[model samples]
Target: MAMQGTLLEFILGWLMIPWRIFVEIYRHAFPPANEAGEHEHEGMLDASSGDITIDKRELSHWTKLSQQWWDPEGDFALLHGFNHCRIPMILDAYSKYIAQKPLPDTNPLRGAKIIDVGCGAGFVSEPLREYGADITGVDMVPAVIELAKAHWNERHPTEIGPDYLCTSVEEISSQRPEEFDMVLCLEVLDHVANWKEFAAQSCRLLRPGGCAIFSTINRTLAALIIAIIGGEHLLRIVPMDTHHLRKFIKPSEVEYELNKHGLVQVNLTGCTPVDPWARRPRWSDVSYCGVTYAITAVKRA
Candidate 1:
C-alpha cells in the first residue's frame, strides 16, 4: 500500500508538469494587468477621476457564488472553516493591541465597532456579533449583500446583527472616514483591480489607533501550485476563476501599503491547512507565507 501511494504521488507530480509549463507560458505572454499597465484604463469605472476600485470581472464572479455563500459543504467550505483561525486573531489583536486589557469571558468585544469589508453572507460578521461587536458588513456584490442581510435576519430575528451594505469600500471610506475601531478586510486584497487604493480606503475607515486586519494569498510559485492548481482544479474546493495568480499580493507589498497610509505593521502570520484533506487552518511562521497569510496593522494615533 505504501509503495502504491508513493507511485500515485509520483505519477500525479509528473502529470502536473505540463500544466505548470502552460501557466508559466500564459503568465509571460500576458503579465499582470498592473504590470502590463492595463490598470491605466482597464477596470476603471470612472475614467474622469479614476477613483473607483471595483473590478467588474471580480464582481460578476462573486455574484455567481452568491447563493452558495452560506453553504458550508459547498464551494465555500474552506472559508467556513477559516473563521476558526481568523476570529481568534481579531479578538486577540483588539484585546492586546487596541484595548490593552483582558477580554471578558462573555461579550468580549462589547462596545467595539468593526466593519467587515468584502463580507460575504455575513460569515465573519455573524461570529463577531456573537462576541458582542457592533459590525457593519459591506460587499460590492448586491446579491451577496442581500444574502448576508437575509441570513442575518433569519438567524437573529430579534437581535440586530451586522448592518449589511451593498457599496464599494472607496465610497464607504469617503462617506465615513475614521469611524471604525477595527477594519476586517479578509481575502479581499487579491480580488480588487486596485489593491493599493482598496487597502488605502480600508485603512482610512479606521480611527486613530484602530486596527486593520487583512488576509490574502502571497504571489509565489507555491501559491500557484497549491491555491490555483491543486485547490481549484484537482480538489475542486473552490470554483475556478475564484483567484488569479497575478493579483495575489505579497506580504511585503501589504506592509508597504499600510505604512504608506500611516498604519504600522503589528503582526504577520502564515495560515496553512492542518492536513492535506482538512479545511481547518493552522497558524504558521512567516517563512511559510507563500500560500496564505494574515496581516494586522494599527493606525498611528
Candidate 2:
C-alpha cells in the first residue's frame, strides 16, 4: 500500500508538469499587460485613463499571486484565518449601529447592498453572499478579476452572484453614487498610493446611513517587526514587497480620514488569536499591539 501510494503521488506529480507548462506559456503570451488596463476608471484621484492610484509594484505583485487568491491554504492562508475574527466584527458593528440584535446565521445580510474594494478572488465576497448581501466586488487587476469571476462561475454559475468588476472605488462611486449600504475595504489600505483620497471615495459610495469597515496593519514599531520583519521577511506568508512599511496607515489616520469624509468612527479593534499554543482561531482583541487592526465607521443619516 505504501509503495502504491508513492507511485500514485509520483504519477500525479508528473501529470502536473504539462499543465504547469501550459499555464506558464499562456500567462506569458497573454500577460495581464499594462497596469492601466488593470483598472477601468475615470473619476477623482484618477480623472482619466491611465491615472489610477494603485502602486504599480503592488498591483503587479498581487497580479502574480492572483492564482492563489481563493486558495485558503495558499499564499493568503494567514488572511484566510484572519477573516474568522473579522467577519464577525463586521456583522456585529452593522447590527449594533441599527439597534438590532445580531441577525440569524442564515442569510443575515439579506436585502443589503455591499461593495468590497480590492476583493481579489472573492473569498470574502462568496461567504458574504451566503449571508444574503448583494455584493459588488471590485479590484484593479485583470488577472485577479478574471480569477474571481471564474471562481464564482465554477462555484455558483447560475445563482445571483456578486458583481465583480475590474475597477477602482473612484470609478465605481462616480457611476453609482450612494448605492451601497456597506463597504468592506478591508486590508487594502497599505497597497495604494492615495489611500486617504480613496478612503473618502469609500464614504462617497455609501448611502447617508451606510457604513464601511477598513482593516490593515498599523504603522508602528510593532507592525514593522511583526508584519514586515516576521511575516514578510522571515515567514514569507505574503510575497516580499507586498507590504511597504511606510505605507502602513496609523489608526489615527484612519479616524481622521473617516471623519474628514463625513463618516463617524464607531469601532476599532485589534484582532489577535484568542490562544496561540492550542492552534486556536483568532478573536476580537482590544489591545493595540499594532500588528493588525480594523475600523468601523458610519455615515450619519
Candidate 3:
C-alpha cells in the first residue's frame, strides 16, 4: 500500500510540473518594466566613464532541485518571496560589518559600483541595491541568472536595478579590470574548486581601497554534522552533497590568500541560519566557531 501511494503521488507531481513551469515563467517575465524615460541600458558605458559588465548563468542542479515543490528541502517557496528565513541573518551580519551603520542602508555599498561574484540568484546583490548601488550580479548558471534577472526586473525593482551577466569570472575580469568598489563573493567558495583563482580575480576587479565580502561554511566536524548531515540529510533544508568539506576554508587561510594578493582583512563576523524548526533565533545558535562566516577585506590603498 505504501509503495502504491508513493507511485500515485509521483504521477500527481508529474502532472503538476507543467503548470508550475508556466506559473514560474509568467512570474519571471512580467514585472512591469520601468517607464521608458527611466530605462537606462546599463552595460553600454562610454570609455570616459567606468563601465562594469556582468556575466550570469543558470542555477546549479542542486539549486534547481531545491526549487521544486516536491523537494521539501527546497526553499523555493520562501526564497521567491526574497524573504528567505536567512534574510535576517544576512542583514545582521551586514549591519555589524559596517560598524554601527544602519542595516543594509547607510553603507558605502549604496550607489557604489558593485560586483556580486558567484551571486546565486541575487539574494545579497538585490538588497544591496536598496542602498542605491549600481549593482551587477553574476553566477555560473544561466537558469539561475534568468531567475535572478526575472526577480530583479519584476519583483524587486530598485532605484538602480542591477545588471545581470552570464559568464565566468575569468571572462568578466578579462573584459573589465579594476572597475568595482565592492565585490561580493558570498556563500560560493565551498562550491568552487579553484578558490585561489576566484579570489585573485575578485581582488583584481576592485579599485584601490575597495572592499570585497565573502561568506562560506568552514570545514569541520560541527559543520559536517550540522550543515551537511543535519541540514541536508535529516531536515532536508539544503540539497545533499551541495557542500563538501574539501572546499571549505578556514579564516586564516582566507586571510593568507588575501594578504598574498594585497587585499587586507578589515573585518570578520560569523553567521548562523535560523533553523526552520526553531520559532525564533537564539543566542545558543550564534557562534564564531561554526562553518558559516562573513569576512570583509579591502584592497591596499
Candidate number of the best lDDT:
1
**Candidate topping TM-score:** 1
Models 1 onward score TM values of: 0.88, 0.80, 0.67
Give one digit per residue, the lDDT tens place, for model 2 in 1-301: 0011245545654455455445434543464444233343222134354335566666778888888877755677666666687777767876887436768767888888889998888878878887888899999899988998888789887887888999877788889988988888888987875687678777889898888899888877677666655454444455555665556778899999888878898888888756432222345566673878888888988
| TM-score for predicted model 1 compared with the true structure | 0.88
Q: Give a tens-digit lDDT track for model 1, residues 1-301.
A: 0011245655675577567658754875688555455346465566345456777888888888889888866778778777767888899999987789999999999999999999988889999998999999999889998898888889889998788898888889989999999999999888887888899889999999899999999988888887877766566676766876777889999999999999999888988655446643333334478899999999999
Which residue runs does candidate 2 get wrong by more than 4 Å? 1-51, 275-284
Clashing pairs in 1: none
Ordered list by lDDT, greatest first:
1, 2, 3
Q: Tell me each candidate's RMSD, in Å, in order.
A: 4.4, 9.7, 13.1
Better of 1 and 3 by lDDT: 1
Q: Candidate 2 at 243: error in angstroms?
A: 1.3
Cα lDDT of model 3 overall? 0.59
What is the C-alpha lDDT profile of model 3 across 1-301, one tens digit per residue? Answer: 0011245545654465455445434433452232111113332222233222221111345455523522222343323322342344444444454333664435534546878898767766777676566888877666777777777777755444778897777678778878987778877776554566677878888877777777777766677666655544444445444555545678788888988888888767676545445422222224475667767787787
Angstrom error of the Cα, residue 116, model 2: value is 0.5
